[model samples]
Target: MVLPLELLQQFKASDFSDQQEYEAWRSRNLKVLEAGLLVHPLVPLDKSDNASQRLRQIIRGASEKPIETGKNSESMQVLRSAVMSLACRSPDRSASDFCHWADGFPLNLHLYQMLLETCFDASEDGSIIDEIDEVLELLKKTWVILGINQMLHNLCFTWVFFHRFVTTAQVDIDLLHAADNHMDEVAKDAKSTKDSVYSKILSSTLSSILGWAEKRLLAYHDTFNASNIEYMQSIVSLGVSAARILVEDISNEYRRRRREETDVARSRVDTYIRSSLRTAFAQVSSAELSD
Candidate 1:
């Protein structure tokens, strides 16, 4: 909470590689502050509030020309005053000592996602860093500011693992496995909460995972072979788990009908396998005729 504001006070352009780098970094932080404090603040703003208006004006001016930083700068002092005034307002009226700026919905998720990225080592070809335990412990400290609970963390971690696996050319079965394992936790969390915001995020996240998994699973004849057959189990489990959660937790139709006879995951996997095998067979026959 104080870190963002603190950085602004102590910032020096000399610390960065170049003036451009410093300016870019400064711009990003200013935008983040503006977003967290004004646009998507955890405590809603009245447009007429002087603090909100002042912060907006400062951010607009900073966008056109960088604000002078340092404790002595009048612009920095005024910016800080406006930001703190806006951030201190809370629904309970008892949180005067605390700031609620960064805890807004999508903003919180985005910040947490960036923090989670630090768990992976960029130099090691996507391997998780050795200090992950320490990094994760530190990350937990920001959960309060980010409005993240274990459930949202699990879901976000699931997405991060799956995304990392995809971005790294899908060679790391360990990443895929890690993703599938995290989905188990996410699935448990999904069953427990019906919060509208959580449900929306859950549906969107799982749908993305399911869609990616099914893309390969539904046409396995082209996607898999002898060398990479090991990936099949994890992909299948991931896809099935995502499908189960979407149907069992997010679907109103499933809740109303309560079909005891249907096995959604199993049926879906079966359909993929059958469809893929038929395609494979037809391709083989066509190849023989051409030969």
Candidate 2:
């Protein structure tokens, strides 16, 4: 397939200040993921060979490389930019899709059970929705362990015309802000002035982590075909399940407490940070470095 002139132009002008910047630029041009539709399914690609090669290259080293063009772009750089940016155009808006799927469609029975038992919204309002940003954030860090890297390697091979394209993972931070703000607006205090506001912020933070996981896990399914989509789905179920369990167990400590929701969320997030790192090591199937 021919590289679009617009793509070339954007590539030539791409910026890179650090790892974060490099990943950001790659997400915009290479991934083409915008908006909040990360969970939607994917169509097969026309340029399987090139796209796969680029995807792997980018994931392996987007932070290290600067913007270059043509053959000089480096596979990791191109892959990082393309897969994530393209696939995650409207990630946050797609958060609702998690509930849709979790309600029981493709996910196996074990996963479905795990999802609900773990990721409940608990809003007496019954208006709970998985914040995509939260899920994406969780899934992003976790996938660094298995599913994401595996997808990269798989895509590196010629498109089997089967495996899903798990090139992207994300949750919109902007939406997270909106959710936190909304929590603030709608909250009715039961105690001190800080209680409701803190609750809102606390829940919003929890929402951000799980929301990122929700979408990142779902977005993975887009990468595969009917045959392998199920495989990716299984991974999603496990990821969300783990997140749900961890979040709920921690939430139970002080979810509705008069003034400790924020504390609980922070404390839990700290634990999660460690767990996430452990998940990373689990995904390090390539090799384990000895200290």
Candidate 3:
């Protein structure tokens, strides 16, 4: 979900600052934007007519504006408008509708607003390392939580091979970004906390789940050799059922911890997964009939 380098360069060029200062500022903001995207992938523009084009226009408009004061500029307004329109037009209209509606374009806009505030503070005091560190840590936690939920969704809704491919690709991208963006600092801070034990346990559990899912996915792919639709159905049913139980267990754990944000996120993801799985199964059934 990295923004295009050319667009980043164009945006940086519009800032009224020296090369070193602008580069530093751009790098920080880019990390925040990347964090935002990691938590919320962009929706496929094909899901809706012209929405992706509109989003690109809004982004390009931001690049053309004065970067220092562009938070409230006309470009920002248009960008907000585009987000609202896309959200409203999305097929999923639940309270957590935006979660399933598109990528984190709207969420990234919020990150930009946070960046604007940090920029304003930096202009006044010239020191915001503490604030920056705090924001980055929060983003890292959000990214991990969202990544887990997204993997769950993919397991339930997507074809086995496609799901495995995309999830593996995303994990690679996330590791690459973390390596590049000083995420080691965030890891260090987490390691220092008492919650580190719980975090490690959760991490272990998630890794095991993914490993199990990979084996199932591979088996499902092999079922194609015999043209055995029943075998394929059984595999998918087992996978989806296991995913639902796992999701429920995690949701209950979040509830016990009183993590309202995680609860909400999980609920939204659960809704979408159930809906999507139903559609996927229906499609498979329809295809069998057509055969």
Candidate 4:
């Protein structure tokens, strides 16, 4: 199965799970668990409350400091662990992880930065490949301890799980053309209709997908803080704005278009948005090692 049968049963739809069975879910899901090894983008559902818009206003307002941080805050630890965890993977995994993390872009950049440092560290004083493999093993351990399936699921309430993986150096690129292939298929269902927030997300997602190639070229710069940064911010803004329109705001514009029924359009939009975010983030970070 593309996804674990057990995992699919649990995540795809609601089901009965005894405590023990739930615990076992994490273990069986590993190895195949995409450890930030793939890339994609976000397009949150729309609501008439316009809450998404309001939230974006606040998020944008506080972009400089997403949350006020103590010298040592939970965010710091989360970022560090995320970065280190990603770094510890093998080079193939590392590249893919960077692409995966790109889904969140600079929003998750601080953690990404930490991964780059570790990548450099491994490059300098250790058995680069072996060391990374070891870290991946350790992460697997941590995943079990953390009840990774449950934790990650809660953390990612959305249906789409943003984990990417690239194990072999010679893996076929086309074999894993980052999803949204099913975006159209999924969108066609009643759930993804335009009046629905899901539909709005689909539309905006495809819209952003169109811009990723331009951003990939800009990754060569270290800071990329000048033009690239501004450009990315604009892209993120578009995503946020679209998400807001879809999830929180409902209007005649949405009903008038009858656009949600169109999956091909949505799939294209999903691809561009996610690819753009991934490429933009890839440039900002230094090096990343993977298992």
Candidate 5:
């Protein structure tokens, strides 16, 4: 995991051709970091502990270095090693600790932007999707475990951005299912702390996502409606069912609070749902007319 000093120098000297190059580089390096876990076979407990500590040290050192070089560079490999090592040890680590450690490195919104680019890159094979999913899953688990309700907005936005790459109807449906699961977890966590503004905001965002998912389901149904597609219909049914459950959950939460602010949040949710539905319907209608 400790990149060679020579490699670090090269990374400092390296320049990306474009955003795509940087994204590809970042994605490849992350994969390398994840793959590094498999490099060492099962060993003695003492030896394993030592190796793990050494890996962490290397990762930490590399992360502190200034390296924006292209993919597979030494610095990238070292940083990836650190990220994966942290992820593997997440059961013992908290999200705040992880974020604090990462804050020392150049991994803020820039890393996420690079990740988003990788997700939207169609030229690559579908493996990138799995990578994106893994990262999101890790973040979601960390946020949930730490009870970081405020981070839900960013998490939700990440999910929404990822929706753009779900080209197929089945994938869209699957994404909705995944979103439903995440939202359910978030809602459960929120319910534990009723009458809190953070919880209310989280609830409002969840409602918006459910409403958006429903519209996407309808849009997918319209786009693929050559004839009676049973799977698509099933997906739509599942989405509707999930949306109803989420909406009801948020409604009950708002009613229980009965605060003016909660009422405003509820109104915003209604507006979001209506706007999303209208946009989805318009897109479908336009497509149909063009056809």
Candidate 6:
């Protein structure tokens, strides 16, 4: 809280291109404070608490008009006092020097995702950094504070890997395969936990993956040719793995049944192959008619 305010004070109007940019930057920091302290705090907030009220009032006013970030400014002092008062309060009323404003559920996930982005090479499109091993080790240090476990890390990494493949023109077969490999770990994590929040996140993440994979697989004849046929196997595997986890692990009805009886991946792949072949045939016939 004070750190952000301090940084704001350290920045001058000259540091930015114009007053508008400075105001925008100041507003973003204020929004971060509001989100961490009031919106999704690690300890559930008490609306009637004096410190919470004061912080909320300050944030609301600052939203309409940016507050002065000067160390000696009256509003800055009030804001700092309110933030510290709220941040210092523990759920059990214990006194502590440490604060946990940024460790809440979705907020923590978002912050961790930002940190994970550093694993990629900024200079080389779609490539991971050579220092990935070191960067990953350092990132692990924040796991305690971010409430991240292996499962969450695997899920986020898979998404990021897959996203890079897409954003960089999808030429990276290794990225696709790496993402598919991560799904194996994700599947294990899915089966081992039944936490409602974790399940919600798992469903959302896997659904995105499955949706993207199926979009390509369901019409593989159109999406892949000899030049990129290597992608088909990995994409199919990722889609099937995601589908199996969603059905057998997450869905209650499917959990009651056995995988041996349904064989989700095999059946799903069979469907994709047949559908793609049919589509390819239909297109050929239509083209002949047009000619």
> Please, what is the whole-model Cα lDDT of each candidate in the order they appear?
0.86, 0.36, 0.41, 0.34, 0.45, 0.84
Ranking by lDDT: 1, 6, 5, 3, 2, 4
**Residue pairs with clashing backbones, model 5:** 25-71
- Model 5 CA lDDT for position 12: 36
Task: After superposing candidate 2 on the true structure, give the runs of residues whose Cα lies further than 4 Å from its correct spot.
Answer: 1-11, 14-27, 31-41, 44-57, 70-180, 185-291
Clashes of each: 0, 54, 3, 26, 1, 0
How do the predictions measure up, each by TM-score?
0.68, 0.23, 0.25, 0.21, 0.36, 0.69
Where model 6 places Cα greater than 4 Å from the true spot, the runs are 1-103
Alpha carbon lDDT of residue 73, candidate 3? 52
How well does candidate 5 match the true structure in TM-score terms?
0.36
Off by over 4 Å in 3: 1-43, 67-73, 92-144, 147-291
CA deviation > 4 Å runs, candidate 4: 1-172, 175-180, 190-195, 213-291
Judged by whole-model lDDT over C-alpha atoms, candidate 5 comes out at: 0.45
TM-score of 6: 0.69
lDDT of 4 by residue, 1-291 (tens): 123222433341123357445434433332222222121222222244243344334334433544322325554344334333433343343333332332333223222222322322322322124364565444445344333432232222111211221223212222122222322233234233433434444444434432332333223233245544543433333333333334333444545666665343344346656765676576445335331
Residue-level lDDT of model 6, residues 1-291, one tens digit each, is 445656766775667888887886787677667777777677778767899998888888886766887667777889888888878777796756877665467877867776887898767888888899999999999999989998899998988898889889998888999899999999999888889998999899989988998899888888998898888889999899999999988998886877578888888999999999999999999999999
* lDDT tens digits, residue span 23-48, model 3: 56655554443333333444433544
The digit string of per-residue lDDT tens for model 5 on 223-265 reads: 4454535444443443443344344445666466645554343
Residue-wise C-alpha lDDT for candidate 1, range 112-204, written one tens digit per residue: 886798889867666888898999899999998879999999999999999999998888888899999999999889989889999998898
